[model samples]
Target: MDLITLTGLRVRGNHGVFDFERRDGQDFVIDVELGLDLRPAAHSDDVADTVHYGELATRLAEIVAGPPVDLIETLAQRLVDACLADSRVARARVTVHKPQAPIPLTFTDVSVTMTGTR
Candidate 1:
């Protein structure tokens, strides 16, 4: 299957286990991989034949900014659901990255990845 990928999507969200984490909010980076057949769009030269990545990006960003969750895993699942909402997407892989997690030790980032199939 052909693939449509959106990487390094950053958003501010209040998702974490700690009180301060939710109160202060933090940056969340999201990456998505959508599996579908792009031949129809390629042949027809019409955007209707394929996913509108711009709209998808907006929706994913909404998910990030909408509600507060306790875990990146939950956010990842929500993203998978959103991706599958488009009928053309047969499979979706979503990753949610937490760069400003609360930890005493220094760390670059932490993330949760999940894949879903419709």
Candidate 2:
């Protein structure tokens, strides 16, 4: 299968177990990989023949910015589901990154990844 990958999609979301997290919100970075056959789009040379990435990006941003979820795992799954909404996508892998997590020690980042199939 061919792959369509989108990375470094950043959005501000209020998703955490803490109350302050819900109140203040933090930036979440998401990466998505969609597995699909690109032959139709390649042959037709039309955006309609393939998944519209710009529209997909907008949808994902809305998901991130819409509601509060406690776990990044849930967020990742939601993203995977969104990607699979396109019938052409056979599989999806999503990674949700929480950079400003409430941790005492120093850490570069915290994230969760989820994969789903149609």
Candidate 3:
């Protein structure tokens, strides 16, 4: 399978277990990797032959900014599901990053990664 990757997609979302987190909201960084056959698109040079990443990014942003979920795992799964919705995609991997997580200790970031296949 060929690969198409989108990384460092940042969006603000109200997702967390804490009430303050939900009320204040925070930025979530997302990364998506889609595996599929790209030969058709490469040969034809037509976007229709493969997934449209721009639209996919918009859809992912909506998912991140849509509803409040307590776990980043759930968010990652949602993103994976969206990627797999495209018939051309054979596999998908998603990472959800929460840089400002409510950990008492200092940390660079917190993230959840999920992978799925059709």
Candidate 4:
């Protein structure tokens, strides 16, 4: 299968286990690998033959910035569902990153990666 990857998509959201984490929003980065049979698109050379990555990006941004969630994992699962619903996508590997997590110790980022298949 051919895969199209969108990496390091950043957004701001309220997602965490702590009260403050939910109250004050933080930065989250999302990476997605969309799997599909590229034969049609490759042969036809038509945009309609494959998924519109720009539209996908917009939708993901909407979900990421729209609501508050207690866990990134839950939000990620929602994204997996959306990918499965898209006919062009056979499977997807998604990664959600939290760069501004309020941790006492110094850390670069926290992330969650998930895979789903239709």
Candidate 5:
């Protein structure tokens, strides 16, 4: 299957276990891989024949910025769901990165990844 990948989508959201985290949002980076057959779009050379990645990116940004969840896992699943909402996508893999996690130790980042299929 052909794949369309969107990476490093950044948003500010309140999604964590700590109260302060929920009160004060942090930046989240998301990545998504959408699996589908590209033949139709390739043959037609039409935007409608494929997923409108620009629009999908806007939707994903909304999801990341809209809700307060307790875990990055939840955020990942939500993104997978959103990806599958596009009928052109047969499968989706989503990753959510929490860069400002409340870990006491220094770290580059913490993240959760999830995959879903239709």
Candidate 6:
């Protein structure tokens, strides 16, 4: 299967269990992989035959950055739903990274990855 990827997309969102986390926003990076059959697009050279990365990112950002969510898992699942909603996508995987985690100890990053198929 052919894959279309959107990597290192950063957005600010309010997500966490702590009160401060909810009040304060943080940078969240999302990496998405979408499966598609590129044969038609390759031959026709038409965007309509393939998935559009910009449009997908716009939709995902709107959902992820909206409202209050306690878990990244929920957000990931929601994103998966959005990804699969596109009939062109055969499979999708979403990863959300919380770089500035509120851990007492120093760490590189915290993240979650979820996979889905249509």
lDDT comparison, 2 vs 4, better candidate: 2
Off by over 4 Å in 5: none
lDDT of 1 at 39: 100
TM-score of each: 0.98, 0.98, 0.98, 0.93, 0.97, 0.96
Q: What is the lDDT of residue 81 in candidate 3?
A: 96
Q: What is the lDDT of residue 104 in candidate 3?
A: 100
lDDT of 3 by residue, 14-65 (tens): 9999999999999999999999999999999999999999999999999999
Q: Give per-residue CA lDDT, model 5, range 18-109, as digits (tens).
A: 99999999999999999999999999999999999999999999998997989889889998999999887899999999999999999999
What is the lDDT for 1 in model 4?
Answer: 89
Looking at model 1, which ten-residue stretch has the lowest summed lDDT? 95-104
| lDDT score at residue 17, model 2, on the 0-100 scale | 97
lDDT, candidate 2, 20-102, per-residue tens: 99999999999999999999999999999999989999999999999899998988888899999999999999999999999
Candidate 5, residue 61: how far the Cα is off, in Å: 0.6
In terms of lDDT, model 3 sits at 0.96
Which residue segments of model 3 deviate by more than 4 Å?
none
What's the lDDT for residue 42 in model 5?
A: 98
Provide the overall lDDT of each model, using Cα atoms, as 2-decimal numbers. Answer: 0.96, 0.95, 0.96, 0.86, 0.94, 0.90
Where model 6 places Cα greater than 4 Å from the true spot, the runs are none
lDDT tens string, model 1, 1-118? Answer: 9999999999999999999988999999999999999999999999999999999999999999989999899999999999999999999999999998898899999889999998
- State the lDDT of candidate 6 residue by residue for 1-118, as single tens digits: 9999999889888988888888988888999999989899999998888888899999989987898698888888988999999898999999999888789898998999999998
lDDT ranking, high to low: 3, 1, 2, 5, 6, 4
Q: What's every prediction's RMSD, in angstroms?
A: 0.6, 0.5, 0.5, 1.2, 0.7, 0.8
Clashes of each: 0, 0, 0, 0, 0, 0
For model 1, the stretches where C-alpha displacement exceeds 4 angstroms are: none
